[model samples]
Target chain A: MRKFFVLLAGMVLFLASSLTFIYVKGENDSVNDLLSANVDALADNESSGGLDANYHRIDSKCEVFVSAGMQIDIFGIGIITAKADGKIAIDGKVVCQSKGNETCRPVECSDLYSVILHGGER
Target chain B: MRKFPYFSFVLSLVVISCVSQTKNEPNVQGISVDINKQADISEFVSSFDGYVCLETYEECLVNEIRKLKMVGDTIYVADDTKITMFSRRDGSYLGKIHKHGRGPGEYITLTDFDVFDSRLYVLSNVDREIIMYNASGDVLRIINTGEGFSNLSVIDEDNIWLYSSDSNDSMYNFILIGPDADVKAKYDKFSKNQSYTIEDITFCGSVSDTLYVSQYYDNIVYSLHYDGYVPLYRFDMNLRNTVSQEELSATPLSELHKTYKYKESFRSIMHIDRNRHTLFAETWCFLDGLALKTCFVKADMVTGKSHFYICGYDVDERFPLFDLSDVIGYDGKVLISYLTAFSAKKHGKKYKIGNLADISEYDNPVIVFHTLNY
Candidate 1:
């Protein structure tokens, strides 16, 4: 009788250990999958020229950094920061900058006029 | 098993909450004006008389006219580059206001201009400034209006009304600025949906002291008082067939054409005659889902009668009765100009009242005056 009781307790302990092991393994796999997904998202944000990560606008102060091609318009009496090589139109004039050419300046009127008057030609 | 049921119940509750969140929006009401019948242009316009011919002269030859305003005896004609002044009595070239440069007083692109109390206000899109000039084309003042202003109208010597296409959190559609470019007041009467590509569709004009404002989508015409805007009139445009803002937000922009297959809308109110209680507008809509048609509309505010007329000229017709242009109201009269050498030349003899024969290919447009028949 004593041997049977000891054997029964040992079986119960073994079953509990097996169930705990399965649950722990399943929990670890889920955690690992979540970590991997987060890492991929961070990688994407970095590869996209940090556009989504570093967009900010305060009053008239705006900073936009895009990796791919984009057409952006900045208005109001404010400073604007854009990525180099991006086409930025401020007050209808297109300004294309090179890499690391982030500068905040007010939009100045272009020297060229859109329509030429025939008064001089005539 | 217990956890499974609980999770399923929570998921179903979330779905139900989301489904119930989309409330049914009420349909906006507007005054519907029937535009199915065609009308005779002569019935609306009492007479199409020769007002003032802006003769294409050497000193004032305009390539493309952007805006026109008549202040007293001077006719202010603004092309894309310069604002050329001409005498309204004899079509004599006075002087040209072409400050085209990168200087402090120069402008890159002339978006719009207005004349009030003998002062000409030229709004530059690139410079974002209003170069105020006297009647003789002399620069009186240079008002720096920040940037992105699409149109402007000089209310008085001390004040001017400006319109911007872009709307920020604080500023809305219109802004009232002083002569020093200081923002006196900003009005936010309209909502920005960001659905349409063309944002500068708001038409603003003033009859004496009362300023009128209207948009392409909204049928209500608003009047600016001290600080608020009051609805003066509403046109029933039958916008039921138009696309709703909810649908616009749901559909991807790429698939917009598939969802809203047809686009029907009114153009900006070009001319509003207060004396005759009449307004003129243009309509652009898909015809039979095949081609786009441009139709002209005239509505009488007193009787609520509106007429839609097709713009064209028959070969045998002597005078082409209807041709829509950028119209402006002045002193109880509405003025519409036509390129006599190009479009109006095809319309036979009666339309050739102006100096059409002398007008060259690159000459300025000829002006036509019409009095509203009440």
Candidate 2:
């Protein structure tokens, strides 16, 4: 009985460690992918380097509003729509999140705008 | 089924380990502030003076005042398009600068401006240059800095500091440039790519020739030294008010905003100003998606005792100009901000203070000055 209990405990411990590793690794991988994808858009070519992927460079005259379902339209940069069910899409590509996903969360219209436009809440 | 107890125990252990990864360990150094608590208005300002209405004219039409600076008797108000000057005593209209072109000494867009020694230094990010002009708007010199920057401050005759928060997309966040537009020194390079957007031109300010700079997303405020930066103060935020820096860096950029945890968290360090041994830091946080809460932190550099307060929140007596929301310039001695005719009249009546009772809603904005204790 004692021997069987030890073996069972060992199996559980191994499984737990493996699960935790996968969880952390998955998060790091997603972050890495984001950084890598922006390389081309944020390259350091002086002539064309004014483009900033982290900010939605809207003209001061362009009116911005946070309406129902988090809809914001920047004339040149396509439309961004975020739904209360945890779905965010820029030009229908679903860049921020999917419905009921724990990954991305928005509490307000400006938060949605910040996520969609400024890349982060800060 | 009989072994269910053992299995459940193992599962609980796994959950605990995962939770421990994000456990909040209170920061031991610096001063920790509870930003949500109510505070007294007197803590921010020692005294409140009257108001002055800036004279408006066709040539000095301002859509909105983004920044206000004072040099001697002149009050410089900069909007998105141009910089207009007014008398400090009576708000009389002085000369104005409205040059917007691609030609010599012209700026495409007015991003930032500073007044030092009767000279106006305007930062043109789109043109990637600094246009130095006399108080009368005559171009003294133009220095083209090859790269664009968000803010610039004249440190002295030889050193000028240009700062930007877009580190991932830009070469450096802090660059010390010479009068000749040469890069004297560059600092704040990250090992990995990172970027955050901020809209304040007050991120960098000086008191007595010493320069202070703070990144919006960073917790530490640094003073520029000869070689690098020296960390002056660290704001240890309560766990309830902030997301850990590690968590912020780990989250993917696309999913960062969607993180509900970040919705009501500490947003950014908006402005930093120092007065003698006391340093004042104004911070912003999301109250909700639609609103924002401003927090003011006053820290004693010598004793390390800090006072944290929320502005425009519950207070016994509300002071309009004392709020950090409209804070334009603070030079250790005086704090200045602008109040629209509506607000000036409304607050002036409710509080029974200032000369704003007679101002009309159609009139120009009234500038209010406050005397500081710290």
Winning candidate number (TM-score): 2
lDDT of 2 by residue, B128-228 (tens): 78999998889998898876677888877677888754423446778888899888888766443333333554355555666777654456667775487
- Give the per-residue lDDT of model 2 (tens digit) for A11-120: 99999999999999999999888887676556744357453233222111111322225544432233544321112212111222111112322223333333334322
Indicate the residue-level lDDT of A105 in model 1.
28
Across all models, the iRMS values in order are 19.4, 16.1
Worst 10 residues of 1 chain B by lDDT: B192-201
Cα lDDT over the full model 1 = 0.54
RMSD of 2: 21.9
True contacts kept of each: 0.00, 0.00
Off by over 4 Å in 2: A1-122, B1-29, B167-170, B190-196, B239-241, B247-262, B273-277, B288-290, B301-304, B315-320, B323-325
Categorize the docking of model 2.
incorrect
> What TM-score does model 2 achieve against the real structure?
0.66
Which residue pairs clash within candidate 1?
B31-B236, B32-B236
TM-score of each: 0.61, 0.66
Q: Please report the TM-score between candidate 1 and the true structure.
A: 0.61
